[model samples]
Each structure stands twice: as structure tokens, then as C-alpha cells.
Target: MLISTSKSLFSSLIISTRNTSNLFIGKNVRLRNYHNKFPLAGIKVTVLKEPFNSQLIPKLFENFGAEITIFCDTSNIKKQSIDLNLTNSDFVKAEVFGTKVTPKKYIEAGEREIDLSVDGDLNVLKKYAIKSDIFINLENKRFGEIGFNPEEIIKLNPKLIFANISNFNQTNSKFVFVKENMNEEYLELLHQNSKTLFTLGEISCFTKILLTLFNKQNSGKGQILNLSISDSLLHLNRLTSPLLLSIPNAFDRFYLTKDKKVFSLCLPTINDQQKFLKNLNLTNSKEMSAKIAEFDLSELNMFLKGSLCVCIC
Candidate 1:
């Protein structure tokens, strides 16, 4: 789930970003948070193409009345039109203000290759970006085409808050790349909580931008933030790792009462196991498990109710 911020912060913007793979699929990111805060009502923003995290940057800026200008290839525009179920013109109007000048026609004039990593590409984009307060680059696919160093682009306009989305943390030392990863090995811990994969990077990067946008820091200049999916999962797992290790053979058990399945790190003591066997009139571990499997749904529900299993650490 996408963590929420303040309501006053979201009201000014039309939230369009969402987490497509998690619970409540396709839910907008803005409907969740509300704390007393400032809004970006008048800031100007320019975004290049749409990436996985594309919905968030614009929504956050919109919360503060920020005027957004999105520049994407014609193919991307058509795809968005189909995805959002809106006409091309209608979609354009929904993203930008009426009075703001858009380079739609200018961009469509030629098949221009805009790569922010390249000095020439950066210069071309700068023409449209010079007038904006922030620049967000979501074109991770074209990141390899970056020719000039990121430091030079920051020198072009130090005041601007630039956010670039890339899986690798090598975009530039000046710009933070939130890394989102998807791996099969994490399935063990991931299945334990129905947790989605590689979403931590998106959440971390979004939080970083919010911190800077609220003037919580001196300036976003020269700051680089990396939020990788694996890194985020590691950070999250650290909280309960010690307690999990405290128990012997904690990873070996997968709780099963018939078809209903649950997991427990609770390793019953020898004394407790003996008592359970005697109470159930069972002689062996296999017999004990068979008795448990025969329990009715309601019986099982009451037996396992409450905090019978808690890690003190």
C-alpha cells in the first residue's frame, strides 16, 4: 500500500499516480494521507516520459498547485490515451494549465531524440525546462544515452529540484536514483506477508522528494538518494531479524491445519509437546498433527486466537 501524507497537501492537485500491482489495484496515490502542511499551488514542473513511478511526482507537485508539463514520444502519448481511456487532446488538457504554453506541436515537428544524459539532448530539453521550477526525468530507458555529466546539468539551474528515475544508482552523483528490483529469492519472506515486490524504492524516492519540496532541507542540490527494492526489503527485515534468529529452527516450520495454512516461529517445548499429545490422546508427532488437521474451522479459529506467538525482541 502507498503511505499517505497530509490532505491539505493533496487537495490542490489532481492525483493520477497509483500502484498497479498491489492491493486495491489501480488506486490513486493521493486518497490515503492527510496531515496539516503546505501545498505546491503555484510551482511549475516539467516531466519527460512516463516510467513506473510516473504517477507520483506529478501528483505530489499537483498537491501544491504546481503546473505540470509532460513531454513524451508520440507512441507514448498514444499508449497513455488508450490506457487512461481519454482522447489525446483531453489527456493533454488534464495534465497542463490552459494558459501554460506546451511544446506539443514543437515536439511533434520532428522525431527528436531527447536524452538528458547527453549535453546536446540536455540543452534541447533545457529550452522547455528553463522556465520551470522543477524537472522530473522518467525516461530510464534512454538513460544510457546520457553524454554529459549530471553535475553540469545541475549547474545549468541549481535552484531546480531534479528527480530522475533509474534502476541503477549510477545516473549521477548529484541526482538520486531510486532502485526498484524484482527477484525470485525473496519469495520466502515475501509470501509470509503478501507483500508486493520492489515497491520500497518507489516509496522511498517519493518520500525523499516530499522532504525536499517542503523545504525541510536547505536545498536538493548535490544530494543523491538511492532506493532499491532489495535494499528496502533488507531494511524492513532488519526489524524482526534478531527475534526470528532467537528461535531454533524458525525457518523450518509452515503451519498447516488441514487446507488452512499459517506460519509460526513458535517451537513448542518438549514438555508442552508431551502435554499436547496426552491431552489429544495421541502417541506420536504424526498422530498429533493428524488430530489438529481434523479440527473444524471454528475450533481452529478459537485455538489460535490472540497473541499466542509474539517475538519479545
Candidate 2:
């Protein structure tokens, strides 16, 4: 599950009781919460790395038949345009904030027009308002320690670092996924043998093969796969592989992971696995056409990739 806001985590917990409610924590997509009270099914949501052209609430409610609330870290000052846009839908507002002294007292502040929060990522929740049932979170990195800039990366981590999230309780997003419940395999073998690595490819085959390896191994016991998986199908190959970015003049961070053995996921088009894995990392050098068609290509999109894809430089 890809719970976007740290603030909306609890109410998500209160609404239902299903193991599918596990939040997307970093690249691992590991399941940390086993005691959820929410019925975790039939809820699949994805957005926020990019914005939709229309209001998502009415559409989600129309499509999903539930209150499609949007919880965002408040990112802008003229949040009213967002508010005006939301007025037509079933969208309401809420906030996700953290107090200075305690990680124990995470609170959700709700206001009809504008949800409130002290930690100040209210806009993070708002970003989902377009096609969601609810709206939550208000932000500015200055307001809280964490918020995103025009760039999609997390801006700051003063109050909550990546490590802090492991300790913090947040709601898991609605996902069609299974939990990587802690097992002796990952635990016993994790004594430094696991390594994290990333690759960027204009050549999709390398990335495709890598993701397949991770999924087959359940995200690998020790290695981490950081992929800059792009939706650009026309360019079927990563004109440049991940290592190309290290050249100093390059731009854009590639997908990344902290663990060495576990592979971070990267599959294209969230849906239609066949189309996503079409090329499956193959190519003819001269004509740039796929030459080696050996692997079984039917199971392309059957395996849904993780909610988390960490980019590294």
C-alpha cells in the first residue's frame, strides 16, 4: 500500500481491518502493521508524483463508490484554487502533522474547508483531492520538516528522517499487494551480504531483467534494485544505463534502495502486465529491434510492482 501522507495513517487504520493496508515504506514495501482494523480490499489508489487534469474525488467516488478523500502536504499559498476546484466534488479536507516533542502524539486535524495540522504537510493530502474521497494534509517544508518542492523529491527531513518513519505509525494506501512479512530468510542473511544498487537504461532489457529477478525472489534477500523505470515506451531502451548518471553532467536520480540484496521494483504502466513487459529488455544493436525472444512473455503485468521506487544519484 502506498499511503502518501504520514498524517492520514491512523484514520486509515481506524476505517478498516485488512493486511492490505500496509503503507509503502521506502523501496522494500515491507509489511510493518499486522493489527489493522480496516477492511483492506477493493481500494486501489495511485497519484501525486504527477497531477491529474480533473478533480479526482467525484470520479473516484463515481468509480470506486467510496469517499475518495485526498490527503496532501499543503504545498502552496493560494490553496484556495485547489479548494474551489474541490468544491464540486465530494472532497473534504483534513491535515497530517507532527508535534515537535513527541512521535507518540500524531494527530489528524480536520476542518471543513481546510484541514489543519501543526507539522504542516496538509497539501500532501490535497494533491489527491482530484479523484479521491477525502482531502487531508497541509504543507510547506518550512511549516514542517518534510514537504516536496516542484521537484518530486522529499524536500527536507528535520523532524522525521527516513529512519524515523520506521518508528512512526501511518496509514497504508489502498493497494492490491501482499505483505513481505518479516521472515528468517531476510533476517538471517541480512548480516551485510545484502547490497543495494541502481541502474538507469535507455535500454529497458537490463532494467526488465533486474525487476524480474527481484520479483521472483520476493524483492531479493539482500540486494536492492533501484530502477528509474520510465513510462516512455517509444524509447524502449535507456539511451543511458544507470551508471551514466555518475558522469557528472547528467541529470535525474535513478531508482535506489538501502539494502544490498533486495531489488527495488520497476514495471511500466501499473496495469496490463503484458504491455508493460513487452520488450522485456531485448534489442537488436543495428536496427534497435528485439532479436532474442526466448523468455515467456505472457506474464508481463501479472506481477504488480511495488508502490515504492527510490531514486539514487
Candidate 3:
């Protein structure tokens, strides 16, 4: 099966177990990760470079033993932040074979700014999209009659794992939304603190795709995972939002110590506040920052025992 995380390297050991010998079709070595626990091991994986997010796939799936082939214009490879010679070494740490495609895409756009929305020919890119089991579409443009079409690519490769990453939200049947898992009152409080009353989009979408990949690998099904940037951030709000709402005035309750360390004190009730003072010799909210900064995490944990206060810094 497809074990997505670094923690579970052998839940279904796709690389060493699966019979995917026919999938290794190319020979040009481009990007490589050499981790002992390769998740996408034995599968010939192709990454489309251009979209900013496509650049992240190799690192994300590095330990999963997939022979990763980056399909991009050769110049794009040079544009990466890391030195060219060190690229192979980085992949080796992740435990996978990495390579790139030849007869590159953008030629005239060299050193000149090229908009991914209109840079390469859609027809040619489509062929590369379904070339492997998993296709990472970071094409920073909309998909349609004139753009990168998702539906069309699936038709070309029915078993392809297609992931479209862009700035905003996109919809598809395979995409799943994570539950916020918070009380109604807590959500309302968090909504007031945020601009659009939504979670950070990038974090949420990333988590959703990870969960989807895990499920798909276990089932051997091609899936489409869609996540909105805003909604995803909201999912994470469940951790800190409730604590902030428990206090009298959350925004004001946040304090900065003399040493420039920031922390929050959320006391749900007067008894809890009294207990906090009795247990830690902390009288007023003003003394909290300095007192907390003086103590280590273990000391703080002890003070928080049998207490309703949420100490977050």
C-alpha cells in the first residue's frame, strides 16, 4: 500500500513489495532521494516542474523509494535555489532516484519572465502529465479548454494520481475537507480573530492531500484531493482558538516578557485564576510573562496541572 508519512515505512512497503517493473520507462537521471524507507519505491514517478508546488514533491516523497523523473524545461532545474551538484545528495538522503526530461519546454522565455499560465504548450504538457502513476500539476493556471485540463489528463491515464496545486481553491470529487472539530462558540471566537474567518490555505490543503495519498495507496485507487487554503487553516485553529476564547479578553491576555518572549494566559474562570496564582506565586496577569519566561517547559507543565489555564507561547 501507499504509506505516506515518514513514520510508517513498511505498512505495505510499495517499493519492495509491488510488482511495477513495467513502470520504469526512462533512463535520464534527474532528482534522487536515497532514504532506506522509500514510500513510492519501485514506481516510476514523474514530476512536472514549473508550478511552484511541483518543486516540493521530491522532498515530500523522497523517502518513499520512487524513481522520480522531473519533467521540466532544463533551465527550470538550474533555477532551483540549491546548488546543482548538491541536488543528488539531497535526494539521496530521502532515498530515491531523481532525474529530468530532455528536449526541454520553454526556449525563448530564457532569463525573461514567463507566466506559467501561458508558458508551455498545453498539448505537449498533457502527454507528460499522465506519463507516470502520480502527476504533480503545479501549473499556476486554470484548467480548461485553453489551460491545463484535469479531466482530460485522467482520460489519458486512468490510474494516474493527479494533484493540482495553485494559489486558490479548486473542486473535484476525490478531494476531501478536514473537519474543524471545535465547539460552535470557539469557532465564532476564532472567526473574529481572522480576516476571512478561514484557516491558512496552504497548510490545510497540504494536510488534506497527505491524508488522501495515504487512503489511495492503501486502496490502489486513483484519487483527486482538493483543499482550500482558508478552510485548511481553520482546521488547525481547533488547537489554539478554544484556549484564547476561555480568557476574559484574549487579545489583551497575550503578553510579551522583558526578554521579548511572547506567551498567552487563558484562564476560563475566577477559581482557575486563583489556583494559578496560589500554585505558581503569580498574582496578576502582568507578572505572567516574566514568571513563565523564567521557568522551563517542565516547570510550566507542573504549574498547569489540575488547572484550566492554557499556557501557549
Best by lDDT: 3
Two-way TM-score contest, 1 vs 2, winner: 1
Winning model by TM-score? 3
Candidate 2 residue lDDT tens string, 1-313: 2222211333343323244456444662323222233222223232221111112222322242232333322222223324333321122112111111211112223222223344334454334332221111212112134433322222221111110101011232111111221122222322221112111211232333223322333423222122221322112323424433222111121211222122223322223223333344422222111221232222221333442222222
Candidate 1 lDDT, 120-214, residue by residue in tens:
66666766665555666555443235442444555765556666654454422211212222112222223243233234445566666666555
State in Å the error of residue 295, model 1.
31
Alpha-carbon lDDT of model 1: 0.44
TM-score of candidate 2 relative to the true fold: 0.20
lDDT of each: 0.44, 0.25, 0.45
> lDDT score, residue 90, model 3?
40
TM-score of each: 0.41, 0.20, 0.43
Candidate 3 at residue 134, lDDT? 68
Compared with the true structure, the alpha-carbon lDDT of candidate 2 equals 0.25
TM-score of 1: 0.41
